[model samples]
Target: MSKSLTYTLLFLIMMIWGFNVIAIKILVESFAPVTITALRILLAGIVVMLILGIRKEFRKVTKPQLIYITIGALTGILGHHFFLSVGLTGTNASNAGLILGLVPLMTALAAILFLGDKLTILRMIGIVSGLIGVSFIVLNGERSVGSISRGDLYIFLAVVTQAVSFIAIKRATETMDARLMTGWMQIVGAFFLFVVSSRLEPDGLSTLTTGTPVDWIVFLASAILATGIGHMVYNKAIHQIGAGETAIFINLTPFFSLTGSYLFLGERIMVEQLFGFLFIVAGVLLGTGALEQSLRKHKQKRMAS
Candidate 1:
């Protein structure tokens, strides 16, 4: 594909992921975090299964892969989204969006620690700096803020769970079909979420009925468009352009989320949050070696010229 088309598609995927935060915030206004996350994952899993069946891609799993998928469900879906869903209750969607920019760096750190990946001085610095940034923004320069609202802390921990899941997923997908693995993981995660939410929330799935049409619209849009379609297109883009090039677009997610939140929710952020977010973004770029890669290309072009 042309670079232009590739970038467009990539940005579109990021946009979906970014704006989904707003959708989640809307859902949280009425629905419990676990309830929305539960229903969303379950519905999205069903959608993915249907698509997989239509494409003749759905298949049975082995015993070992099942265990791996179960682990993935726990870390990726159960713990990750559960924390994120609950976290949004106390935090602004825009700041939560920015927190996601730490994924690349956190994922890199996870790989280094768990997968025996090497880390360099520059990358380490990036990781440390990124941590400081996340702390600054999440803490908002007040140690008391941590007590006032755990939304930031919950969201930060959600990323940690997600990063850990990436390692498990990497190991599991070595022999498994990526699509099948993802679909099954969602199914498993959704099942657990359903059970947990049903038990904890006395309403027991009544949240769906209690909501208005607009709520339903937002819920379905988030599940189908943001989670399902977004995942498919992102995986496709990664295959097309390679993971390295694809990652550059993810940084745009926070910007899109910020814009959407401001327009739709009339949300505003503190200057400290922006600074911390930039620190996280810069750290991610540096730790992932994306910054160095860009600089190398620019230098090469300059010398050639």
Candidate 2:
């Protein structure tokens, strides 16, 4: 696996993820948000389980690991997906894509608060920048006060929940394989989502059968390619190249998502959204220490020279 090939694969994975937002938007047009999300997650979990079985990686989790995995399942899978699917119903995919770029910064904040990670000056700046960037998207260049939409608020909540889940995921992965944890989390999350959807959306399951062939295709691709295989490849890239290198690629996701929204859904991109993306890129670089690491390497090379 050459670096070039690995990078290309990562880029494609990001594209899949970006287009998945568009797929969700399309699916929500005909299916209930919670119902479709639950079904997709359930399918993704089964796919992951198949992969784990092929690799013979299944094992019993300790009580502590189970606790963390449960937390991750609830926050990352159940909470995040619920909000994101519902959010896309009330808002366009383009806005959701841009707003999700705040995940890295929010994760940084979560680490500082829950994991006792140090808050450096750069991180502080990054936090402010990311928040401002997301606010721009939420406001969508409107001059009127209170322009924030409910969907935008839900998207932000999704980011927050996912960020918190990262903390538990980190803990769980210390004593367990990430793939295993992910598989279990998805299964557990899907169960809860089913329960929730049944209570809130009595006709949700029936709506699944009402989708066209195209809708089913998009839904399957989003679940299998984006959620199932995408996660596996991403984790593999982290193992091969390192987490920092892999994380830098995440900055490309919003752009890919924006492009997908434009091409597939015919959504318009606003100037403010582009500007917000710039802030988000800068924030992720700073917030995730990618910028700091690059500077350190440069300084080291200069001293050696």
Candidate 3:
């Protein structure tokens, strides 16, 4: 794909994901979080499988790739979704969106620790800024003064699990296609979610039947557009453009999430949250090397001129 088209596609994908946070928040008001997550992920997995079947791109996984893929399924799919769903029960969608902005910073650190990537001074500064930004969001919860919110903590855990999952996914996709890995990971993760929901939420399955038509529409759209095809396109971007470049676009997600939350969920945007977002944007640009790369390109262009 041309660079402009690739960027445009990624921008749209981020918008879909941003709105997905609102979708989940709305769904959790009626359905049990874990149960709903299980159903959504299962449907998304089915969508991916159908796509793979139509394209004839499904391939058998070797033993080593299976190990990494399984790890990714557990952490990325099951763990991340589990925490995020539960977290949204207590936190506003606005806060949850800002907390998720930590993923790129955390993922960069994970790459350094797990993948033998270099740690630069800029990255160190970015990491500190990101953590400070998240602290503002977490501590500014709707509770007692200076007390951290449990919901914020769960969202942070979700970020941690997702970062770790990226490491496993990076390894798994070394030889395997990213789409195949995503399909298997989501399917396996959905299975585990089902088991967990069955154990902890015995009445959860019944709630699904009670949803209104509008609720079901939102649910299906979140599953199909946000989780299924969104992830597939994101993984493809990571494959084609490299992880660092792909991650820079993630900075756009929280802004979209903030807008969606304000418009759809009627959530207020706090000043502290806005400050947190500014720090996060700077951190991601620096952490992902996008700022450095941009400067380098501009300098080269100036010299050429």
TM-score per prediction, in order, is: 0.92, 0.96, 0.95
**Candidate 1 lDDT by residue in tens digits, 4-59:** 88788888888888899899988987787798798898888888889889999888
Query: What tens digits encode model 3's per-residue C-alpha lDDT throughout 34-76?
Result: 9999999999999999999999998889999989988998999
Model 1 pairs in collision: none
Off by over 4 Å in 2: 301-305
Question: In what order do the candidates fall by lDDT, top score first?
Answer: 3, 2, 1
RMSD per candidate (Å) reads 2.3, 1.4, 1.7
Instruction: Encode model 2's per-residue lDDT on 1-305: one tens digit a residue.
Output: 88999999999998888888899999888899998999999999999999999999888899999899889989999999999999999999988998888887888889899988888899788888887788778777663446678898899999999999989988888888888888889999999899999998999988988999999999999999999989888877877897767878888889988999999989999998898899898898888776787788899999999
What's the best-to-worst order under TM-score?
2, 3, 1
- Superior by TM-score: candidate 1 or candidate 3: 3
- Provide the overall lDDT of each model, using Cα atoms, as 2-decimal numbers: 0.82, 0.88, 0.89
Off by over 4 Å in 1: 1-3, 141-148, 293-305
Clashes of 3: 0
